[model samples]
Target: MNNDFKNNAIRGPINAFMFKVLSGYMDRLFGKSKRQLFRNHPETVVEIGSGTGANMRYLKPGTTLIAIEPNIHMHANLKKSADKYGINLEIKAIKGELIDLADNSCDFVVSTLVLCTVKSPEQCVKQIKRILKPSGTFIFIEHVKAQKNSILRWIQNIMHKPWHWFFEGCHTNRDTKQVLELAGFSSLKLVSYNLYSPFIPIVSQIRGRAIK
Candidate 1:
């Protein structure tokens, strides 16, 4: 087998396992905000980086979810969660940066903690903009860089490299708010807050909607 493939084969399972184990705790930390932000989702929705269906609980029963999750290791658990939630799941094993969906075809696009891990946040946002219908909404909840010159920011800088490697490219200090602002959304509403979690690097978070 190719060395890269071999590495991924090992890393993928570990990451998936970690997500599974921590999903509940994470939900407890962010669930309220997610619930508020995920309200009134369309019947059909596209989710970028839908790992293990962490957002499934917020979706209504019988919702059609097109999940873009590249990590095959997460598919089985994701499917299980979809079934539990009564979601009509369509798994697309693809990256967020280059979605296969046609332009202007999606009514709603949902993402949770995704921008911090995608290879290119700019390209992913551009793709999201391209696919969303006129006046469509892109809802998101993402962890981002802490206040400048703060203890959390210092910790994020110190732990950046190891955390990125261990979490499979999840950046501890991405300026996702700025990214969304520059993405040219017709209207954007974002609220920043600190999550009181043991995971210090990811405590700084923002959640809101951006209209296309």
Candidate 2:
């Protein structure tokens, strides 16, 4: 499988279908906690890579949401989901690296399962930091590189290229936590956990907030 197949075959229809099936479970597992992290209702919220608007349902009342989704194929569903959920959303069909917002414009930035696939993760973070208010918050949930010397770690290394090709440029082993911290977040907080399965062992995960 190549990048084309990954985007057309896997990322479009299949990815949307899979999300439809798994979103409820995902919400139950992690979405609630993420919502709690933003309970204070930021006036301006920007969710990068808001695929199908899964996070739309979690937005707090009176928040003005900017949903950035680079893929055109996902836009319709994203709009439908936002409308269905009654969210105050503005859709932007653009990449995270070129966020069409002014400096210090947004109060909160969010990314969930998105950093791994962005063309330049560091650039995305830099843009986020640029647009965020001085006291703004950046919240993220990402699957990352496994523990050193572990079987899963070795597997991730071995499958790196193939996995990227199969999953629309998603790297299985990015050190995204460190990337965010290095991107100049003022106060950073993150925690790691694992989701082990027969097919994929020790799938490492991280979720937290970085205050700018």
**lDDT of each residue in 1-212, candidate 2, tens digit only:** 12243247446666666666677877877766677766775667799888777887787655677988766666777777867777777888777888889999888898988888887889989999999899888988888888889888899888888877655677888888789768877899988888554336227888889989
Residues 60-172 of candidate 1: C-alpha lDDT, one tens digit per residue:
99999999988888899999999899999999888788899999999999999889988889999999999999999999999999999999999999999998877878899
Candidate 1 TM-score over all chains jointly = 0.95
TM-score of each: 0.95, 0.88
| Per-residue error (Å), model 1, residue 154 | 0.7
Candidate 1 Cα outliers beyond 4 Å, as residue runs = 1-7
Candidate 2 clashes between residue pairs 3 or more apart in a chain or in different chains: none
Against the true structure, what is every candidate's RMSD?
2.6, 2.9
